[model samples]
Target: MAMTASTAGRRYSNATYRAMRRLKTVGLYAGVAAVLAYMLFPYYWAIVSSTKTGQALYQFTLLPALDFSNYWQLFNNPVFMGALVNSGVVALVSTAISLVIGILGAYALGRLHFPPGRMVLIAVLMISVFPQVVVLSGMFEVIGWLGLYNRPSGLIVSYLILTLPFTTWILTSFIRDLPKELEEAALVDGCSRLRILTHVLLPLMGPAIASTGLLSFILAWNEFLFALTFILTDENRTVPVAIGLLTGSSRYEYPFGQIMAASVTVTLPLLALVLVFQRKIVAGLTSGAVKG
Candidate 1:
């Protein structure tokens, strides 16, 4: 009887412990689901809102059907088309400058040692933290002096404040991780520094360059303040600013569907980019995290 009682007690304890462990696992999954829902709800809301009709939208229905009427309307509008063009132009131009300037500057800083090289790297990183508003005063003055106000070039120049420092610093870290032996061997063969950089390091650092370019492009695409301040007309305004104007238009009472549709279009390119380079980006981010 005593032996049977002890065995029963042990079984009960083990069963209770397993039950508690299962409960804890379920709680953890519940917490994750809550957080994921919080973060994703806005995007889901936008997607649903884009499909809703004006009456159904105003009715505040919870579930809207997936329809392309709003998308069709957005594309039919000339203003929306113009905004897309302006955004493309600015993003392309700014990315081009950032890529060229960033690659060369980062390579020089990372590879060639000189006085205050570390200080320069720190300063470059700091530029990324400086608030965009702080530069407004200086940018406005420069624009005024150079007569670049309202020009596409002015927006491109302003975007450098957003792109360059991060680009330089990020690419510097990437370049530093490249094999030093490759460059040394090139030097042993009597190859010039510029040739080694152009012919050897450039080819190997392609993925890093692509990551930097993608980031710079995203920044340029989403920039609003500087574009809003400088670009007054339809021809020069980027998509974000133009979309803001679209929401204020008197045509059919600030169509939510149209605005959301345009937003989806604007965000699609970034979404595609993130999907394509997801692994590369994750690796780039964690590259030197555990350097020995």
Candidate 2:
């Protein structure tokens, strides 16, 4: 009788342990789902609101009304179209320029031995942390002096202040973590430093480049203060500034639907880019996290 009772008690304890573990797993998944919903709800709402028009827009429903008149109106707006082009030009050009410069800087800082290397990197980091508002006056004076004010070139130059530091820092860290054997082998093969960087390191740095470039593009694309302050003409404005200037039929009315539509339009491309490069971004971010 005692032996049977002990066996039964042990079985009960095992069963309870399994149940508790399952419950814990379920709770963890539920918490993750809740967090996802919280983060994604705003994007979902923007998309739904973009599809709504007239009285349907004001209705508090989770589902879209299936209307697309807002998008039609958005595309028909010439100013928005022009702004879109300007934003693309600024973002792509700035990202490309920053990457080129950052790669060179990263190579020098990461690969070469220099006395003031750490100091230079620290200065770059300090520059990066500076608030846009603080540098606005200085950047404005420089832009005017360079004859780039009221031009896309001004926006691009201003964006370098934001993008270049980030790219340089990230690329520097990534390159520092790379094996020296690759560059040594290239050098053994009669490759010059520039050739080794271009041929050997460049190919291996794709993930880092993609990650930094995407971030730089996003920063430039969504920049507002510089775009607004620099570009005087409506035709030269970027998406963020142009969207802010969007007006409704009457002075008292707000074009909520059109604004949402524009928001969705600008956001979709970024979403697509993220999804496409999701693997690369993850790989780039996690490359040096663990070692054999």
Candidate 3:
């Protein structure tokens, strides 16, 4: 009788432990699902709202009416279309320039040795810590002095202040992880530093470049203050500023539907880019963590 009771107690304890483990696992998954829903609900709401029009837009329904009139209207507006084009031009130009400069700077800082190299790297990182508004006055003055004010060139230049530091920092970390043997081999083959970077490092740096360039592009594309301040003309405005200036039939009335549609339109391409390059981004970010 005593032996049977002991055996029953042991079985009950084992079953209780399993039950607790299963309960904990269930709680963890439920928490993750809730967090994801919380984060994603706003985007889902915006997508649904973008498809709504007229009186239906005011109705807080989960189901979208699937009306695309707002999108059609936005595209038809010359100012909005012009803003889109301007945003693309500025973002692409800034990203390209930043990448080129950043690659050269990263190579020098990461691979080459100099007395002030580390100081320069720290300074570059510090530049990004300042708020855009903090440097707004100085940047505006510089833009005006350079005769680039109200030009796409001005926006591109201003964006360098944002993009360059980020690209340099990320690329430096990535470059440091690359093997030194490859560069030495190239040097043995009579390859110049530029040649080595262009031929050997460039191919290996694809993931880092993609990550940095895409982020730079996203930064420029979404920039508002500089775009608004520098570009006086409606035709030269970028998407964010232009979208802000969007009005309904009356000045007091806000065009929620059109605004939501514009937001969705601008956001989709970025989402696609992030999704496609997510692996590269993760790889680039985590590259230098391990020595071997």
Candidate 4:
């Protein structure tokens, strides 16, 4: 009887311990979820706020209304439309140019054991991080001297500083992580460097390309400082500067509805891209660290 009682007690203690451990795990996950919700609430609030009519906006409405008034105002406003076009042009051109250059450069660095390879990469990183303000004067002088001031090309040139280096470094890391045997076999078959790069290497770099291109698009799309500093004309101003500088132009403070509408409008393309490429993004981001 004594042994039976002890055995039963042991079983009960073990069950209690397991239950407490499970509760602890659940509590931990719940805490993490709460933190994530706190972080995301502002963005959620913005989505809700953007849909609210000007009167309802400040009235503490929690739910986003199913309406098109804000969308209509955003589109019908010429300044918003102009800013949208300028932002699109700048983002598309910069992303395309940076992709071309970054892909070629990344491939070369990945394949070649050239002298000063590490040094070159370090230099590129330094150039990418050098402040937009530091280059402001030189950029202004060059653009003005060449008569490209207030032109899209001038803004494009300025944006390269924002996009190119990060794109190259990221893609270089990705290319380095790809399998080496394919390149070796192609080289052994007497394929030239260009042919091998075009056929064997690039074909396998779909994830890297998608991630890098998407990132480039985001960077160029969101850049404000260089856009503001480089382009001064109404027709040429990128969305950020247009939205940001509006406060100075209006006496009663810029319209919150207009600003909110513009903010959401500019954010839609990027937001959509993020949603569409969500899976690709995760794979691209993790494959380098995991597979490498």
Q: What 10-residue stretch in candidate 3 is worst by lDDT?
A: 283-292
Global lDDT of each candidate? 0.87, 0.94, 0.93, 0.83
- lDDT for model 2, on a 0 to 1 scale? 0.94
lDDT, model 1: 0.87
Per-residue lDDT of model 3, residues 13-83, tens digit only: 99999999999999999999999999999989999999987788778987888889999999999999999
Residues 238-275, candidate 2, lDDT per residue (tens digit)?
99999999998899878999999999999988999999
Candidate No. with top TM-score: 2
lDDT of 4 by residue, 181-210 (tens): 988998899999889888988887777778
Model 4: colliding residue pairs: none
Candidate 2 error regions (>4 Å): none
Residue 258 error, candidate 2, Å: 0.7
Each candidate's clash count: 0, 0, 0, 0
* Order of quality (TM-score): 2, 3, 4, 1
Cα distance off (Å), candidate 3, residue 52: 1.9
- For candidate 2, list the clashing residue pairs, or say none: none
Top of the candidates by lDDT: 2
